[model samples]
Structure formats: C-alpha cells, structure tokens
Target: MPISQDRPFEIIVLGPPVSGKGTQAKLLAKTFDIPHVSTGQILHSIKDDIANPLAQKVAEFINAGSLVPDELVNQLVADRIKKDDCVNGFILDGYPRTLSQAQAIDTAVKLDYVFLVNVSDETIIERISGRRVCKNGHVWHIKYSPPKTETVCDDCGEPLFLRDDDKSAVVKNRLEIFHQNMAPIIEFYERAGILIRIDGEKHIEEVFQQFVRHMIYDLRNKVNRSSGGSPSGTATI
Candidate 1:
C-alpha cells in the first residue's frame, strides 16, 4: 500500500546481529514521526513496573535470564501496538521471530514492508568482534572508532575488553541460531511480496538512504500500477 497520513506505515526491520537493522529502524521511525516498537526494549521496560501482573511475570523471566514464552511476548506486542503513539504506525525491530508470531501480527495489522539489511557473515563477524567496551558501558569499535589510547576508554582511562558475547565464536553461534529461526519468517514475508532487501555493509547513512530509495521507488510503482499507469505528481516519499 502507498504510505499516507490515513494509512499507517507498519514496517519491520529484519536482519542478523550487527546488520544495522536497529539503526535503520530508528531512522525510519524518527523521519516518519512514528514509534520504534522494539520488543526487547518493551520487555526491559516492563521490568520496572512491578505492580502490573504482566510486568511482574515478564520481570521474573527476564531476571531469571530466560526467554519469555512466545504467547506472553505476542500478548505484550499486541498491547504495545494499540497505544496512541502507534496509531500512525510503528517500526518493529525484533518481535516476530517465529512463523506463529508473524501470523499473530498479521491478524493485528498489515505490514507495509520487511526491510532486510543484508550483510555477509564475514562482515557481521568483523563488525561484532571488533567491539570493545568499558566499565561505564561506553562502546567503541576498534576498527571504526578506536579510543585515543590503545585498549582503553577515552573518557575514563579504563581498560576496554572484548565482551564475551562479541567474541568471534559466540557471534558465529548467534548467527547460526538467528538464521535457523529467521529462515521461515523470511520466506513467509517474501511469499507475501513485502520483503525488501538492501545492502547494509555500507556507511550507516548510506544504508538508510538505500532503504528510503527502495521504498519510494517501489511505492511509486505500486501507485502507478494501481492508478492505471498515470502516476500522480505527488508520487514521492
């Protein structure tokens, strides 16, 4: 559907770790003045509201370092998208992992697009493994944004160490698991003909621009086809 004020832009940004989908989602949400509905952030925020029973249950699972059940997650997401901020639509960062979850979302709202920020395994490994952080949680990539001092935080002079999760082996394992879970979800959206893949191994701004160009191009084509080949003058994003 052509994005308009009346029709909300229900979008999903999908990609493996370090694919920059989160960054692109944030950009799209900000540019479109919509909410970035990240399930991970939603789960984390719910932990603070100890009075709500749902929040309490979610906190228990989070605090115990266990994944929340899919049913609970689906319910949480359903409730989240009903909020006023999501009326104009929202960018979903990481909710529908399983086919069941995707179908659940389908019943709630029609997704405009699922943008896959495509990056090679080698690039993902390189991008993730080069990450370093300090005690204060300041992050820097050794290759992209190194600190003034080697192996140290610029702000506090604390030694920066590689996070266990950012290690090469751990990243590889995460990629394997992500693909296994994401394959069917990708296929589902692809079959529905809303999956848009864009190269993400470029500069962050370039990646965002590429996504926007694809969206505008495809949306204009759609409008043209629906309007019997004579596109409107305002056929722009």
Candidate 2:
C-alpha cells in the first residue's frame, strides 16, 4: 500500500552500537526538520521521572550499567512517540532490540523505513577503540577524529585520554552481545519489507548524502503511488 503524504511518516533506524546510527539519524532529522528521538538519550533525560514500579525497575537496570528489558523499552518508546512533536514525524534510534519490541512498535506506529547501517564487527571495533575525549569536552577518534598533535586536543590544548569503555576488549564484548540480541530483530524488519541497507564503512558525509537521497526517493514514490500515478523512481526536493 502507498503511504499517505498528508500524514507524517516515521523512520526507524536499526544498527549496532557505534555504527553511526545516532549520527545519521541526527543528520536526516535535521535535513527533514523532524525530531530525532534516541531511546537511550530519552531514558537518560527522564531518569528522574520514575514514578511507577516499572520505571523503578528500569532505573535499577540503567544504574547497574545494563540494558533495560525489551518490554519496558518498548513502552517508553510508545509513550514518547505519542507526544506533540512526534505528530509531525520523528526518527527512532536504539529501540527495538528484539523481535518482540519490533512487534510492539508495529502496534504503536507505522514505520516508513527501517535503515540498517551495515558495518563489519572488526570495523566497528577499530572505529570505537580509538575514541578519545579531552577534559575540555572535545572528542577525537584515533583513526578518524585525530587531533593535529598526538594525544592533545587541537582546539583547547587539553590532554586526550581514551575512555575505559572504548578499550578493544570491552568493545568486542559489546559487539558480541549486540549481535546475539539484534539478529532476530533484523530478520523481523527484513520480513516487513521496509528494510533498507546502507554501507556504513564509507565517509560520514557520503553516508548522509545517500540516506537523504533514499529518503527523498522513498517519499516521492509513496506519494506518487498513492495518487494513482505510475510509480517513477525520480525524486525532487
């Protein structure tokens, strides 16, 4: 069925940690002038709003540096998507980590697209292991965000240190856990026929441009088909 252009469309981005989902979602949301709702950020922002038993349990898990169960996460996402800002449309990131969560989301909102930024496990480890942060709030990637001078912030002249969590061993463990949880979710989106895979190993700007183009194309096709016109692949924005 063709999508209704009169109503706002929701976009769901699925990817492992450090696969640039957050960055890409932010860019797409900015270009489309929509809200970028990240579940992790949302939970962090509302950490003090625990009024119910479920919220208390979620808080406990978060405080323990563990992931919240899928059910609670889905409920949080569903609640957030009903807000006024999301009425116009929004990008969802870091939710739907399991097939059950995906089914719950299907009941809550219509996902126009499910974008998967595909990157190898090795690449992800390499990309995240070199991340460094400075005391002055500057971030640098050893391979990608390198400073002009080694181990020093180019802007603030502060010493740059690797985050303990960004170490290779920790990152590898995280990746393994993510794959174990995410494989079925990916399959769910695939069966839904809305999955769009994009190569994430490319430069950040290149990936952003490709995503924008795909969005425009998909929106245009949806609109055209809804109006009883022959579907054309061309899109203009």
Candidate 3:
C-alpha cells in the first residue's frame, strides 16, 4: 500500500549480518516514499552535531573504541521517531538490538509490522566469508562478485584487503553474538503477533516479492476490510 496520507507506515526490518535486511528495507522505503531510518546512519548523522550533549557523548564513546551503550541507543531511537518526517511513517532498518531496546520502542512508537528476513546459518557463512574490502569501502565477494584485479578494487582502484572481521573465525563469532542478542528480541515480536517471516535465501527480487506479499498485500486487505475499500480492488501491480 502507498503510505497513508495521515498515518503512513512504520515498519521494522530485522535480519542477521548477511541477510540483506538493509538492502530490502531501503528499497521498500523508497517504493513507498518513506524514510529508511537506520541506527548506524542515525549515529553518524548526530556524531558531528557537537552542540547536542547526547551526540557529544556518543562521539566520545566511538572515539574511545567503545560501543554506544544500549540506554543511549534507546534514547536516540525514541527521539528519532518523533521527528516531523517520521510523523508520516518511516521504515526502521536497525535499532532494538536487545530486549531492553525493544521495550523502550514499545513506549516510543506504534509499529505496523516487524519483518524478520530469515536465512540459514550456512547461507550466512557463505555470504560473509567470501568477502573482500578496500579502504574506500568497496566490498566484494570472491566467488560471486570478484574485483577486476585480485588485489585492487574495481571502483576505486585501491588495494583490497581481507577485513579482519570478515575472516572465517571472526564471521562465526559475529554470527554467534547475533543469535545470542537477537533470540529474545525475535521472540518478543513473535508473542506480539506482528512478526512476519521473509525467506531471505532466495534471489533478491524473489525475497522482496515475499516481503511485499505480507507488508503490502496483507496490509491492503486489512485496510479494505476496515474502510470498505473493495478487497478485490487492491491488487498487486
């Protein structure tokens, strides 16, 4: 459905590290004319705002090589959702990494849907392990998307290196941490009855089709029933 004029749409997209949640969320937000609010982007947006005390605090933590604690993250999200653009609705790509953050979100905004892009652990490993990066942030997967040169980025002509975090051992540890942190948050949404599962191992277009099947097609049906819009009138283009 198109973003409603008054209420709009607020969606939360979740997935593991290599699951393409960010990619899909950006596309969906663009298709529906809404903001794609990612926590990482939010942090970066504020990091240079020296006058904001919270931004100062967040910047210090990053400069010191420390993670921004959950309380600050929650506060940032709560404040972000109240902005004027978000009044129409927005797609939240990242945030609520813990149960505490999820609870904080409960008091912050009413979400329309929470979509979990589900991919197998094996798929995650393959997707993340075959990776290479450059100083300019050009990333490539050796098997699927190799650079023109073995040791240089095609886009920037910069030397490519194996990111320490993209190494096999580090990928496994990251996946483990993901499961440990995401399990409770996933269950929290499941119990709330707004969680929808999107199979993410398929081709990108196929995965997005599945996402729209629930997010747009399903919501359209609900809107039709509630407002007397014909159920048959709302067809996927």
Candidate 4:
C-alpha cells in the first residue's frame, strides 16, 4: 500500500535495556522521513538548560545511570511531542516504561503502532555487563572490547571505566526490576493489537531493516485505508 502524505503517523518503540530500541528508532525515522524523539536523548540534549525543571532532574538521573520517575519523564515527553518537527510524524524511543506512563502518553498524543523489541535476559546481560565507557563519551563492550590498549580510550588515550549500572550485580537487578515493571505495559499494548514484536538478538542491521519494513508497511496500510482505498498487499522495498 502507498502512504499518503496528507496525514501524520506516530509510532512508539519499546524494549528492555540493551534491546537496541534506540538504533532501530533512529533508522526507522530516517527511512520514513520523520523525527525520532528519544526521551532519554531529549533529556540529555537539554541537560544544561536551566529553564526546565524536569530537564534538570532528568539530567541528574541520567548522568548517574538511574531511571527518572515516570511522572517527570511523561511531562518531558509531552513537551517534546508538541514541537513543530513532530507535527508531521515521530518515532518515540525510551519512554513509557510503566502502565501509568503509557496511559499518560495516550492522553498526550495519538499513537498508531507500538514496536516491541524482545531479547532474552541472558542476551541483555551479555550486551550490557561487558560495556565500558570513557569520560570522553566513547563506548566499548568487553566481548567486543576496544584495542589492546585495554583501559584506555583508543581514540583519545583517556581512561575507560565500567559504568556503575553495568556492573554484573547491578545489571542483573536492573533487568529483573525492568521485567517486573514492563509486563503490564506489554499486556496493555497486546490488548490494543498495535504491538509488533521483533527479535532483538539478531544482527543490528537486520533488526533495523525489519523495523523499517514493518513501519513502512503498517503506516502505508493505514494511509491507504484512511483514503477509502484498497490495500496494495505488497511489501515495501
């Protein structure tokens, strides 16, 4: 089906930590020519902006590798989606971690689809526990660790350190807590019939391509039907 340019489409990308939601959302937004709105990235971008209290709080939590309270995060998301760039369409990542947050989002804006990237707990731990980052903002995973320099950043020669949340014990606890909070939200979306599940254990490029195909196919079908036209029943290239 062909996507009409007349109406906007909004999508929400949800997943556990280290599930690659960020990468997939960015790719889908580029493919569909829409803005990618990451609540985390948005908060990070305005970390130093003093005018917004929520931004300040979010920056503090993010810098410490902790999650922000749902109420504050919801407000930040609502504020971001009201911007001009999101008028046409938007892809959301890293928001709505709880059922309340999802309900808050429904009140703030209309969502057309929810893409859920599912990865095993073992895979998430393997991906996150081996992670390291430098003060200069470079990141590396021990399984795919940086060069022989070891503790030094290959690009800047600065020291690299393990993030507090990436420590083995912390990662385990975080994943457990995440699943506890996420189950309800997953059930909510499932009941809505707009949830599209994708396996996140695949190669990054393959996962990204699959996400793009799903978004294009779904959005085009919605547009076609909105115009009172029949579906083309063809996959997007």
How would you order the candidates by TM-score, starting with the best? 1, 3, 2, 4
- How well does candidate 1 score on lDDT at residue 189? 91
Clashing pairs in 4: none
Write one digit per residue (lDDT tens) for candidate 4, span 1-237. Answer: 112233356889999988988888888888778889887677777788788777677778888998777888887877787777776778888878789999888766667778899999888888887877889899987787654566887878889888888888898999888989889998998998778888898999988877778767876887899899998785543
> Candidate 3: deviation at residue 212, Å?
1.4
lDDT, candidates in the order shown: 0.85, 0.81, 0.83, 0.80
lDDT of 1 by residue, 117-227 (tens): 899999999999999999999999888998887599998889999999999999999999999999999999999988888898889999999778877876787779888
Residue ranges of candidate 1 with Cα displaced over 4 Å: 1-6, 230-237
Q: Indicate which candidate wins on lDDT.
A: 1
Pull out the clashing pairs in model 3. Answer: none
Ranking under lDDT, best-scoring first?
1, 3, 2, 4
Per-residue CA lDDT of model 3 for 1-237, tens digit only, reads: 222344547789999987999999998988888789999998998999887779989998989999899899987876776678776688888777889888777666667889899998888888887888989888898889988877889998989898787778888898899999999999999999878888899888999898777767777788788898778553343
- List TM-score per model, in order: 0.87, 0.82, 0.84, 0.76
- The digit string of per-residue lDDT tens for model 2 on 86-192 reads 76788999877788988888776678878899899999888888788898778888778689877889988889888889899999999998998888888888898
Q: Which predicted model would earn the best TM-score?
A: 1
After superposing candidate 2, which stretches have Cα over 4 Å from the reference? 1-6, 50-57, 64-66, 132-139, 147-164, 233-237
Name the weakest run of 10 consecutive residues (lDDT summed) in model 4.
1-10
CA lDDT for candidate 4: 0.80
